[model samples]
Target: MPQQNMGDFTLYFLAFDHGQNYQAMSPEERNKERFTREGVLELTHNHGTESDPSFAGYASGNSDPGRGFGHIAITVDNVEESCARFESLGVKFKKRPQDGRMRDIAFILDPDGYWIEIVPNKLKL
Candidate 1:
């Protein structure tokens, strides 16, 4: 995957790993509580470019076929400040933020276009 030149690729907020804990709960228990407690949270909050069909929201549901909802990538105006604002709204930056002069960090966006945030590394020219 490193060969893809992911170009400052940063996966934030969406990808998660489900421990074998959910299987312990009954389906109804899962929904009434666990569903509300989505941990293996795969959220793809944005879709469509300025051209294609676009609608943004939480992932419709989990599907492994790469057709799950898509992630929102933002070109932020200020990385540090914007990241702080987003962190206030439950959007946590992925632990391993991409660090470099040329690349910037990224986050997820909520429905109001308020969550995801990114800014070019100020240290870069």
Candidate 2:
């Protein structure tokens, strides 16, 4: 049997308060395929092709009007620097930058109370 091409589909939409959510979500200079500007944020994963089930990417919005557990993550060149920048802009973080079991990380809540995980880009792979 020929291998089936099972591409990754849109799994879920996250929520954030600021418009820079896309920048925070993408960071690392990746291309953003689309931006609805009407509460829709789309992203693409560098790995895992559309033919791979493990290939995953998602969209984010400004509202979390649904009852479900969901969150978004982004890898930064420096967690502290990123946190500082966001903080200077009056953004709130749920958990300050600290040492995690696997990596140094932090958490910030969106307008809908979803946790946004920020970690070092070195720990992404």
Every candidate's lDDT:
0.44, 0.58
Q: What lDDT score goes with residue 109 in model 2?
A: 79
TM-score for candidate 2: 0.43
Pairs in clash, predicted candidate 2: 7-50
Residue 46 lDDT in candidate 1: 30
**lDDT, candidate 1, at 106:** 63
Candidate 1 all-Cα RMSD: 15.9
Best by TM-score: 2
Task: Please give, for residues 2-103, the per-residue lDDT of candidate 2 as tens digits.
Answer: 111236533333333344544445423222423333334443333346467765434334245354446668878898899989899888777887645544
What is the C-alpha lDDT profile of model 1 across 1-125, one tens digit per residue? 00111233332332222453544666565445534553334323232333345534434222333565444454545766676676687775542135444345765545443334364544533
Which whole-number lDDT from 0 to 100 does residue 100 have in model 2? 51
